[model samples]
Target chain A: MINNEVTKLLNMTYPVIQAPMAGGVTTSELVAAVADNGGLGMMGAGYMTSSQIREQIREIQQLTEGPFGINLFVPNEFHVSEQEVELASNRLQPIREQLDLQQKEQVDIPNFDKVSESFQQQIEVVIEEKIPFCSFTFGIPSKEIIEELKQHHIILIGTATTVKEAVENEKAGMDMVVVQGCEAGGHRGNFLSGDQESLIGLMALIPQVVDNVSIPVIAAGGIMDGRGLMAALCLGAQCVQMGTAFLNCEESGAHASHKEAILHAAEDETVLTRSFSGKWARGLKNDYINEMHEDESLFPAFPVQNKLSQDIRKAAAAQNKTAFMSLWSGQSPRLAKKQCVESLMEHIISETRKIGRKV
Target chain B: MINNEVTKLLNMTYPVIQAPMAGGVTTSELVAAVADNGGLGMMGAGYMTSSQIREQIREIQQLTEGPFGINLFVPNEFHVSEQEVELASNRLQPIREQLDLQQKEQVDIPNFDKVSESFQQQIEVVIEEKIPFCSFTFGIPSKEIIEELKQHHIILIGTATTVKEAVENEKAGMDMVVVQGCEAGGHRGNFLSGDQESLIGLMALIPQVVDNVSIPVIAAGGIMDGRGLMAALCLGAQCVQMGTAFLNCEESGAHASHKEAILHAAEDETVLTRSFSGKWARGLKNDYINEMHEDESLFPAFPVQNKLSQDIRKAAAAQNKTAFMSLWSGQSPRLAKKQCVESLMEHIISETRKIGRKV
Candidate 1:
């Protein structure tokens, strides 16, 4: 059951793929550990600079000789007004005071031209480093970039939150697509559909996507253990991409407090908020999310809002105050466990076999 | 895989339960067809009076000798101020005018005591009719009622939207619990968690609920075919209760426009709205939903708001105008087929066997 088109294409023993969660969650050690354990491990290059991406690829190559992947964020054109930024800054004033941090003026808002240029450089690095696999989030890359990647024999994967998005990815020549369900953590990958419409559950998402596209479908979201893996496969997905399950692993770069918050969180404790970043992401409910519930829509978009909250998140982490930090988690946090990659992979495989036999 | 504890308990050969959809969708012919085809059929007796329930039970008995179930809405104490009802009526005036419905002199608002009395009478009818299986939505019944039903050898089921609600049902002596996911159509059965918190997807809701409770879990939400059944089973559900799948059946009493809307809908076309009944329900986005979006939160609770919009919906249905009627559907409308219950059952069973043999 574990051996199929996905395994053959990715050249892995198991059909598990570690989700590339940005903001320092996917460490090279974590990626390498999963690769060594017969699963595809992906480095989250969405927020990394070209230099950082190159260095991590080298570091992972030394840790494991197995094939690994990298994921990049396709930059979307966004508008940010100065007055809106000021209003957002004023709203964060109380949180800064609570963190006892000095108020800094002139936050560096990201420029779209610079972001797009950086993405190009990141793609070049993937080709230069000869990474076996590369996945994209937010949107699909241009025809030229995809052709360039394919020229270098890099298998490209696209992230989608709807069947139309999946069809678009297939038309754009993606080798596979990860269908992110509403139960997923981190950022939502809805490009064509609105936030509310893109929230199709895995139970409905996988089959619909598979029926529309010829490429192998990878299901991502609140999948934690064997039950999720088997269910995804039964729903027509060829593989499963997990984020929260791997984020709690020992080798992950996630903060201790962030890990603990998920470890103790209930299924209903997580809520989707664009407060941390302009794009809606699922995370544990805290004081910051509650405070920004009303004003989240008024804040700047994506990289801009993410940059504005950097200092507060850093300070909160330094002080170990989880309330001010983004504690990202999927809906199935109650099933999360703090373990190593090898053990998690072993458990998923064994339990999947057990269920397959029993059913 | 089809034969399990749930099937044994329900005295059915297949692990399929036709969702007890209210509002005349679950006709006697439809229920009898499902029962005769190896699945457990259920009557949506939530809105039926004592005499209506008795008549339906007798009607279904004449159609099929197989066992079937009935679902009741547990009455909750509600307060309806005259001002609020008037305000709600004023808000709905434009829709009523659009539908050309005449304004009545006095709107008969439901009272809590009378609703409770009606529920008691309904329960007495179920007992007298010797219904083999009974289920409750919104909340659990009283302990004395459970004891009385058990003494009569009737199997009890409870609907839940979260893990805590499932545990409560088990504690209340429910023989089984149906975990309704966010992808489910119709009214949400969230008694303990808020609307937002209770919207856990089936991918996250099923396994978490299964891990917490000892009773059998029947997965519900966006399930339309054999793939959904196998996926739900893999997620630890002993059976699956489907609504939208059965709502479009040939024998179902749904309006022709309702069936056509679902048959032609896309996966992302449905959305959750409270304008129809003052309770959150997933359905196709139409004129009524779009117009009432801004004022849905201000509408009176359940039966009160449900009463306020009755005339408009009835007129729309009579005229075959889907824009004003509630075309309830799940996320996977693309998978729905306008077939008879017997053909649908045979397709599901064959697909399940094929998937089982392949996997």
Candidate 2:
């Protein structure tokens, strides 16, 4: 019903995007379904191996000729000391007991120094496939890498938590920027620091980002339906990238328990905690988080905490226990329903039109 | 441009309610001007004594025949121990020295147990005058009093920070509720433990409140214009209450420094700190707050801290030093302008129409 630069640039029928949620939730089928529905479906390559990402992209390419996107987590460099690991392990030991995990501590925690290779390999896959669109979160890529992606004629969209970060993305010559607010689910794409103080909410962050930046802006966070879409556009966002709205899509690879947890979530149930991944992420707060989220010193930074909690998360998911799984959800998770992406897309469009008629 | 139940209930042409900002900001002139322009203007009676509020109400009655609102801060009970006071005073000594205040600790702080009298007297005035609209923040009023207000045909509205708070307001028999989000400037209306974690943003808060309570919903916080009205309406809000949007209106009673600070605010500059009132509030983060906001233990409980910092706020306002003033502002403070209320209201109506044409 509405046309904008985002719809034109991404070559999609609508300005809505199925936000590329990382951590194995956004599956190839989900991407294909959203793309088939005329929204830009994004293939999340953050946790995928180079081969896995390539195969997924190939599957989507075959499923629909409609343009889609690939999302990558820009890797950060950090040193994890043995003491921090020990402290994290010790602190997590009590939580494992509470969750009744078979293992005390997760094994095979990837070393950050060695993480660059996998990240670089994934980037290579993106470049080789000549993906039409790509977005990066957690941080920004280096100038050389950005230039290489641009050389392939890929449009790069950067994620920002604050205006300062959005300006940095523009300075890096990103085609567009996603202004992710605090109400967003999963890990916060905060590159400046690990503190929660930098977390500004969407209503407050959008207008500020719009006024300061010249590039097209994509609004993300608590948006769940067409009302959210309308609100985002009113706030000056050219497009909206919604994760939670598509979180329970039938084609989504999210765990069954994750979907159920989202459906059962109340308005204020989600809490922004680093207990799951050592990075601030909003998820439906459960017994597991309440017990372990008291101290930050006990968590060993980023990938370390993310990797260490995998066993517990996996065990919880296997048993279908909502308490222990990292049910990444926005504050508006209550709005989520278990539907196919196409059906959900139809609902959003219709609802937005209904509201638009009266507006 | 838009019509809803809120406009009909409040007898306004627009679905906009000028927020009743406390701390000497919402002047009688501003209230009358906004009401005269066909919007439901609110007279902030949060800081005034019963006599002062009565005088202000009478003054506004003479200035404009249009309907307006009166806001009262529901009182809280707390006892600040000598040790807590001493600890707070000790921590504040350094900051006081920097500000060049002759005295160290402010004396004659009002007691919360005694705060009941003043709060009770204000309620008596509202009842006596048969005020058309009344709203409460910080906590819910007693049931008996709510019933009395309803008997008098007072359209009672309650302020809420979360869904639980909104439900509580409805349970107490409020006619409507104001869903104030974290993006709201001034003291958060949180009656729960005074922590910033309870602060939820507008995008995440509005829909949740709308569904949980049967009462008509008024969305507040970070809403700056008619675009905000359209968004709130789409989210199921019957009306929108905006504070920072009109803080710099020509008829506002805000200090020059206060207005200036809001006009120049950045996206992430505001912080929800207890340093100002011992109640968590969002305001432009200044050098004084930066120096003293490290630990909550360093501040005494509510009104004591509010009383302790009175001299600094007064002195800063007089000398035009924004660094030491509270400078209460919502997240979208940058959207504020030095203009008259009537003209700003007209601009908002026109802009909403322009955006509506595209939608």
Candidate 3:
């Protein structure tokens, strides 16, 4: 029963994939550990430059002979005025002051053209490196890009938040689709559905997406242990993509304070906020989130707001001040444990087998 | 494998409970059909009078030999000014005109004392009629009422939306707790957690509640079929309480227009709104909800706002206009089917067994 189409396609022992979380969370060590443990490990290359991506692919290759995947953020056209950027940056003056960072008059703003070019370079690196598996988030790639990747014999996965988006991905020639539920951490993968409409839970999302699309469906959200894997399978998902569970692993590059915050958080403590990035993301409640709650809508879109908060997030992390850093976590923080990837993978596999025996 | 503590306590063949969806959805025929099919059928008695409650209990007893349950709404103290009620009522003038209902100068509003008195009498009917099982929503009952029910050998269940609330239910001596997820249709049962915080999905909620409380957790939300039933069990829930799935059953007393809206809906079509009532509820988006979206926070609390919209809802239903009526549904509308309760129960059971053999 464990040997399904997803396992065979991915050439992994289990239908488990470590979700590609952006930023510095997915280190080479973490990806290699997950791959060596017989699960698909995905490098979070959303914010990495082309050279950084090439270097990491080489590093992971040295650590493990097993296959690993890489995820890229599909750049979306964002409109932001210089005045709006300045206003948003000034609004964060107090936070920057609190973190003892200098107030700069000039900030390196990201234009859509530059962002689009960066995404192309990242995709080129993936093709050049011949990564076995590749996934795209935020939005789907163009026909040319998808065809180029397929021509290299690399498996393609698309992230979606609704059935309509899943159908779109299938029509766009994606090999598989990852349906992200509302319980997922980090940035939402909703490109078609509006923010309010896209917040579908896995219980409802999995079955509906499974019925609509013929391709394999991967469930991603608050899944933590073996129970979640079996539950997702029963809901008609062929595989499970976990984020917060792997974010707390020993090899993960997440800040110490971020991991500690998730370890102490309850289910209800995490909330959605667009303050950190123009896009909505779920994280633990902290002083920065609370202080910026009221002005979340006034900030500029995506890469702009994300760039504005870079210095503050960096300074806070360096000083070990979790209250100012973005502590992304899913709703099931209570089930998270600080451990090695090998032990976490073993526990999940064993638990899946145990539940199989009982049910 | 399905005969767990909850099944034994509720004295049912299947660990399925027809959720007590208030406002005339749970008809005696629906309750009896579920009970005859070996699943626990619950009466939605939150809005029923004492006499109505007593009459339905007797009618259900005649139709089915198996045990059934009833649910009550625990009254909370609401503060609203007479001016606030008038303004809220006037805000619905457009909807009332659309429904062809005459707008009244004064709307009869509910007070805390009267709502509390009604709850006490509902409890009296349950005890006097010797109902086998009882559940409470909105919040847990007082200590005296809990002890009184226990003394009569009535199995008590409490509704919770978070781990803290589940722990509170266990401390209050509830035999079992229903952990309602954000994907649930109709009104939210959150009391302790705020609106945003209580929106945890079942993928996160079930496991956390299972770890925190000793009582068996009954998973609610977007669960629709045997896949959901088995998934809940794997998540450590002893049983499942389904609302939207049964709401579409032929035996249910929901308006035909309401059922039809759900049948044509998609997973992302349902949204959470407090426009219909003072409290937040998940339902299909309609003209009425969209009109009141901006002024949602200005309305009075439950029972009061629920009372203010009564005339419009009734007229809309009478005229077959679903736009102004409340069409409650969970996130899994695509899986909904227009069938009898017996077929739903049978399908869920057979599917559970089928999944058990495969997994």
Candidate 4:
């Protein structure tokens, strides 16, 4: 029964899922590699438009016939007040002056319209493409949308931080829940109320969710290798989704500097900060994170704060200045290997088997 | 330089040292086992008398001719007023009644005399016995005592939570520093105060300490297996120290229930709570710790609270009630192997070598 679920998700002999990290880092090649290796490879479409996501999904199909997934960021309308944004923007004026750029007119609410438009269009594409699996992050998609996706026989996985969220996802008729711990990279998926209480890690989160809900649980966060994968399974997770580990793979589209930073990162080098997108996310601690932490007024709410700092981030990336870029990675980034996706998956599978035998 | 320093102190091919856990868990057999495996074995003398410590050390010596160390809990004279203890005791009255105990009486302060007597006597014994290493926790020992111990040419290791503590240890002429992170199992070693700002994990702590001071840095806390060992080494730690990992081994003296609890523990199951020892320590979360957290007034200072609850803890352990026992373990206890010391170390060495190659 376990093998059936595992094989169905990854189209592999073993059930392991490589997390899709969008924004050009998780590439079609990486997705294809995981799919080819008998695990599910997901294409992250957080920053991409519907057309871009379509192209990436089609690109993965071109290389492999195995099952793959597409991950989407559910549009969140929560925004910081106008006063908060101006206060945050004024604090960034010094950096603006330092960058020798003209200060743009003050805008109260940050633009989230782009995100909504992209999400809506991406859903249409998923329907048209008949994507085998789809996952939502940040928050649960609307019931109407979930029903629509279910009608097409799509495997719907919802990201959850707490057991309550997992139960809610199961009640909403989702196929599975990804129990994201505090140790996970990227935006924390605190969709339901009382998300802070849900900051329970994968170790505690997986088993409790498994015991509480009747659905299969997928473990995420801080899982980097076979040992982690095996441990998750032993703790009741049917499969594991790894994001930061694949971020450094040769098939990833992450910047060379970003990959290098991850390879050299110590377990302590990562910190959970909201400096990047005005939402709590884990990344390599650098000057930008440090500055925002020191002066909270410098960071606006998501999309707004995220959009305002987009130019500086791009400039920093172009200049290879990693201290200012969001080098998103998990605590186990140091264990990540610089190898092709197929080899990495093979290594993970073999290692997990060894761990299983030891257990 | 690092290798030589490590070899000289622990008298091992490698400098890895395992932290001593108290309350009868870290046994003489466990110490001897680690020493026999070419790492420093330390007997925790936190709650034992001078004679008991001497006997434990002698027991370890009889088991292995290899070098071993003794760990001491430096006296932390936290002056919680009588009223406070009374208030805390009053809060515990309900539970005390349930256990059929009389109203809590004034438990005398555990004499600091025992600590000094034990230290002075242990120093003489170590010198006479020519023990290779001695480590201190809770706080640094007196400079005069440290200097006296140095005269015996005994290797000294001071535990530190922050870089400042590491620097202070070096300034005090200690041989090495065990960089204990916030994730450490037993009581925290936050000597150089300020709300414990350094919250640094092993990965970040080791490199920063290595960069800041010119001494061998031994990393501790949350390190369980070979990947952790390799990751610490890659971060510039001379070696690694693990307590909870060793506690699950066959040689460990921890209660069978404690061992079972550790084996069954998940990643996020451990939490930092002051409920057990008046001082902050990490252990498997249970009803006692949870209740204490919910009712802050129900806990007294270290030694006092620890002394008062000793009977209850013993009864709980005797009854095989996991919810009432201390259950000390780290976040990665799930990764620990329930095997003999020799086989566990062999697995660690092999796994470490495999991961080391990738780095």
In order, the TM-score of chain B in each prediction is 0.99, 0.95, 0.99, 0.93
Runs off by more than 4 Å, candidate 4: A1-4, A75-77, A105-121, A162-167, A192-214, A297-300, A349-359, B1-44, B52-120, B123-185, B188-280, B283-359
**Model 2: pairs clashing at backbone N, Cα or C within 3 Å:** none
What TM-score does each of the candidates earn? 0.99, 0.95, 0.99, 0.64
Cα lDDT, all candidates: 0.93, 0.83, 0.93, 0.74
Docking class of 4: incorrect
Which has the better DockQ: candidate 1, or candidate 3? 3
- Assign candidate 3 its CAPRI class: high
* lDDT tens readout by residue for model 3, B1-359: 59998999898899999999889999999999999998999999999999999999989889988879999999989988999888998999989888777876576688999999999999999999999899999999999999999999999999999999999999999999999998899999999999989999898899989989999999999999999999999999999999998999999999998999999999998988888888899999999999999999999999889989988888898999988989999999999999999899999999999999999
Give the residue spans of candidate 2 off by over 4 A: A98-113, B104-106, B192-197
iRMS of each prediction in angstroms? 0.9, 2.1, 0.8, 9.0
Model 3, residue A333: what's the lDDT?
96
DockQ of every candidate structure = 0.83, 0.60, 0.86, 0.08
**Per-residue lDDT value at A190 in model 4:** 81
Model 4 chain B lowest lDDT segment of ten: B194-203
- Deviation in angstroms for A293 in model 2? 1.4
Clashes of 3: 0
